[model samples]
Target: MIKHNVISVVLGGGKGSRLYPLTHQRSKPAVPIAGKYRLVDIPISNCLNSGYNRIFVLTQYNSASLNSHIKNTYNFSVFSKGFVEILAAEQTNEGERWYQGTADAVRHLQRYLQHHDYEHLLILSGDQLYQIDFQEMIEAHIETGAEISVATIPVNAKDATSFGILKSDEAGNITSFIEKPNSSLLPPWESEVNDEMKAVGRVYLASMGIYVFNKSILTQILEESEGVDFGKELLPEAIGRYKIHSYQYPGYWTDIGNIDSFFEANIGLTDDIPQFNLFDRNTIFSRARMLPPSKVSGTTLDNVVIADGCIVAAERIERSVIGIRSRIGVGSVIKTTYMMGSDFYQTLHEIEDARANGFPLVGVGENCYIENAILDKSCCIGDNVRITGGAHLADGDFDTHAIRDGIVVVKKRAILPAGTVIG
Candidate 1:
């Protein structure tokens, strides 16, 4: 059942420089997660699960992969009015500059949005990892008679400094807002959270970068304000003018903003019960690939999430994620790593030719040891290659890989020659 009178706009973030080489060729939303799904799939899936299927993904930076992923993945029935469309930044009569910020992205796409019939607009960040019942949020908005609703989560003081903090009234109306406030100013910023959050020291309410706005108010704000951002400029200024309500969300949510957070989020899936439950009924939809099941030979695997079409002969793989079409040779020991795997399987003749010319294969080769690392898509790790990432190694960007926050990221399609060693 499609939810009527609502449209969702997913903000595919800017250059994503913080994610570095991972964003070198693809947009942030196109970055793969959970071994099989791209980051964009999370929000799109959430919208679909919530019965809000009419989604517009706004992207400005490298969007080729994101476009392809969305095209192949989402297809509604011909009789249905549901569609997931991509609105890329284009040079039009209005302006040619790329998205200045989150609000600017939406502002640029106003013409497209105005054509659609919607009472409310659901704006979401494409880089966040969580599953939310947006229908519940919409129902809350109607119940409170709010012109704007911001989803907030209780975060501790340390984490509060990194987000836009809010102070809400006893009635749940937002009273004040601050953008990444200073620690010294946090004494009086606590909001009333559930006892569970208070017990864990999460007293401050932080914006989750999720929002719902009335159509008329959203249009009015865009037409009147020159603000380029939501958290920074628009929301702060619109506090008194709009009936903004705070919708407290108690769930597992994380912003995949940088490499360290990205690495930890993927590795955390190996836990007995992950915070972000992928095994639940809220299915995360992605491109359907007709690939064979993973085949392992003599490899002892523990707490690993291995995707389909993998051919693993590793000596042991522990606490890691092996993505689709991964090929691990015999005697390789992969630990605490995310191997993004190959885009396509190499033909038998091509593999033989590469071996004949002493070239590395598409995936991890024999006798290799990799830890605390992320091997991007289609990387060629040669035999006997050793990569150990830790605090001891100085951070640097090299031809084959880059080290950020003690995690070595082997660039996409990079070739690490045989006997290559790094620490």
Candidate 2:
């Protein structure tokens, strides 16, 4: 039953300055997650799994890698009327400026969206990690006959202040919305609390940045309003004028807005029973690279996720997510770190040249101690290097690396000399 009358749009992300260095070369959506997949894959996979295939990913800053990944990964059969497409920002007679905000990105694409014969527009953020069936949300929207439905999740008071909070009436009709409200401004939970929620503790509703809007309503709001963002402007303005509702989602969802959250989200996957399951048969799709299985020689790994085509001769690896084509030399101890492996393996000649040039081959060198850090794709760490985030340094940006939330972030394709110490 192809009843989902929806066309999905994923906001590829803005400047992505919060996730610096990582976003230095690639867009936020292109940032590798779970060792193998990019952040954008989550929303696109969700749309596909929910039977909503006609999707558009809006991109602006540093989109080459993202565009390439999308092109190589998502190819629907000709017979299937489903296509995953990229809608890069462009200058038109209407405007020449880049995407101002989330809502502005969608509004500027109205020329294309107007032609699509869809009932609803499913808007999502590309940097979030979660799995949801949009069909269920759509059904709820249809049942309530709402002009717009904002997907929400229960968050504790501490985390609630970081998100757009909402209050609903008994019937799930959204009454008020506040964007990143302070502690004093947070409203009490209006809807009934479930037993599970009560047992966990007091929690408030936070907007997940996922929204469903009727096509006509979306068009009308964009046409009438000058607001650039939905949470900060459009949605709040529509609260009284339009029939807005809240769809509560009970699932594991995290907004990887910054380095701390991104690191925690990736490390959380190593849990015994992770909130987000990558092993589910329902696939979280990505660009399928033809590569051999990962090879580990005498390495003792615990609670680790090692992706394909990796050669690990490390002495010990604990609670880490290793990406594809990673080459870890002997005696290295990687602990609670995320090694986003290389884009491509170094050729024998390149390796030899690197060695001759006194640089480690495009991966971790022998006897390196990496802990509480993130090694971006193709990072070359020399032998005896120490990258521990125990110095309690909040943030610092240097030529070869950066410290974000105390975690050392070796920049993409950065080269650290032998015996380099970063603490």
Candidate 3:
């Protein structure tokens, strides 16, 4: 195990443009996941589990909900020194522009990082769903004495065009790199399921945006890379000047950057061999400790994952993930979906600020039924509503709330009145 002192800073400062409708009012990393948790939780939890405490989260667009969630849910006030802070874009020594790219975000925070005496600085994205034992990667980086050790996985050559495809030596030393190339040059590794994706099996030790940087080298790279990013600029220079290496992540990892991928990741969790490690008790992903047991009043569930403190009253839920303290009323049908409450309250009555800044109570309307669809966290619907298929609806017309991928995607805290047929 390569050993080095490290501090992790998550790059969550994007508009999360692809996750529209859902991200219309919030940042991508702040986007809810697994029913009751935010996408950012995956990385934050990893940091804690991996023995790193001090963290800084960078944010740019729709940061209100993201900031509030961090403040309310991730209460690290117990630790005086170990803290989590959000760094919004500001008029830095660099300029007064919003974060232009990945490299720029770190560039802007160079001074803040200078104050810390960490041997290494790990950079991660807040919008991914994976359980990475970063401690193991840190060990490998220290042992190799590499300037930059990227956490990578193998990918097919055909799909490598979309990423910085690496041609590494047998010793795991990266030799060449290509960013997002065409699939015609695909590699021979057993391609991961669904290789056609933007970053599927084309892995080939491609950057998972999980970088272990020598803190000293980072400052230098940032200075030299005036307008650089992890993918576009600094990596190329690092590979040429330093002993850049690759550490294969044999575990499950998914970058749910877009709509289809995001949907699949949610559905992916239900698989018998789930790619994520929700059951890894040793990990640091924090779930609220609730006292009351779940109350399934009259609900009929089959092949479902229901968390603690839930109340299912005569609802038919199948192949779904239900978060803690959520209420599903009677005669409702939920399938192949994820339902999580961001309120963190034991019951609707207990929630003082039910909307929590325009956020709605987490509930499925009585007698409402949905199939092959997703209801984002904290969304509520009225009774007798049907969400079937509408592959041909426009945004401003037909289906009113909001149009995402030709299918209506309701945002968090938005109420759907009774008898609403949202196709």
Candidate 4:
């Protein structure tokens, strides 16, 4: 039992199409980020920090990575009564259809939800990065008696067209909702960037993709919908009916849907003035000292955010993120890269012209020298390998390996032998 009126549900079962190659072998929520952490860690960690226990993670697609990560990383077993459960869509009496949409995913879990006496059901996507107090949002929802209270973020006008824009009234009550509306078709409140947008504020309220639903209303909507999505089906249908309140969470949040977004979000952590603070004491996000401190000895590191348990040699690492216990070989020069400290080998092994998909890109110097390249997790770089060529690119295929235009994706645990070159 949650002991409270709220139970958090993390929707971890989306087929991440935007993160194609990375999701080729794993789910999007399981994709590695900031070197050592996965995409699911963002919301789960947020839940833990927000003081919301009794969580249920719904998963589809390739979920082995997600399952392993949940088991190994979060320490879910310690909870005597409060537990985190993963509900994978199995062949039931109905049929074995993959999750159709977000609404459908939740609808499938109605059995468990129906049994709970909680007043509110908090639904969250497991792939976003943010640190906001959900307890505050829950309080607001209860105070307003809203049918559905959504968490919203104000995105720049240029980015508004890409999201499911929510047009709300002066009282935080949603008025009009549009899913990825065009510049010309927007409301007058949304401002246009290139003399086109019909809306003002470029400051339209969109879903952080998170929601707090009154359990009764949520059940009613799901029962009516049978199987539908929040963005595509539910929200569109819920307009002008019930109290669909929007809980504005104005904070640092990013939906890591692509390589560029993922890479940039990770690099943002190294900024002198970071927009998103992951280590804030506000208790908006939880803290876990699972790993030891990062080790930097014979290396010269300048302007880098290094995570726990790392071994750095006499290598020069600058403007890069090193994850837990990662090994930096002697004489290796790393720059403008993000490496997950937890996934690296302690020894300088034979690596290939590879990547950790979107993870610690094992960069090697020219002699041992590498420049401006990304290495994925467990990628073996030979004794001497170079991922040279700092050419500006957007999205293209590199023969067998697909680069997101400019980004070089290294697959997990790939081994590149000595004397190799990757462009």
Give me the candidate number with maximum TM-score: 1
Q: Give the best candidate by lDDT.
A: 1
lDDT digits (tens) for residues 1-423 of candidate 3 = 444477788999577777776787789888777766788888998988787878889888888888887776666666445777789888865588988878888888777887877888899988878887889888888888788998886655643555666667767787766666566655532333334442543445577888888887888888776765788777876786888888878777877777767877876777777877566685535545653788887777876777777778846888777776677778988886666554644354544464455433457757887765656656677667777534565543222355555545666666776677766
Tens digits of lDDT, candidate 1, 1-423: 335589999999999999998999999999999889999999999999999999999998899999999999999999998999999999998998888999999999789987888999999999999989999999999889999999999999988999999999989999999999999999899988889999999999999999999999999998889999999999999999999999999899998999999999999998999999989999999999999999999999999999999999999999999999999999999999999998999999999999999999999999999999999999999999999998988888999899999999999999999999989
| TM-score: model 4 vs. ground truth | 0.86
Model 4 lDDT-worst window of ten: 191-200
The reply for model 1, stretches above 4 Å from the true place, is 1-4
- Give each model a TM-score: 0.98, 0.97, 0.85, 0.86
lDDT of each: 0.95, 0.91, 0.72, 0.71
lDDT of 4 by residue, 1-423 (tens): 123567888998577877766787788878877766777777777777777767888998899977877766555446444667778877778768878888988888988777766888889988787777788888888778788888887776667777888877777888878888787776564522322222434356677889988877888887776546798778978888789988877567888867778777887887887787756775432224466666666788787887777767737888777776676777788777776544534433333323333223343322356555556655556556666534564566453345674666655566566776666
- In terms of TM-score, which candidate is stronger, 1 or 2? 1
Off by over 4 Å in 2: 187-191
Which lDDT tens digits does candidate 2 get at residues 297-410?
A: 999999999999999999999999999999999999999999999989888999889899897888999999999999999988999999889557768999999998889999
Residue 329 Cα positional deviation in candidate 2, in Å, after optimal superposition: 0.7
Please give the ranking of all candidate structures by TM-score, highest first, separated by commas. Answer: 1, 2, 4, 3
Assess candidate 3 and give its lDDT: 0.72
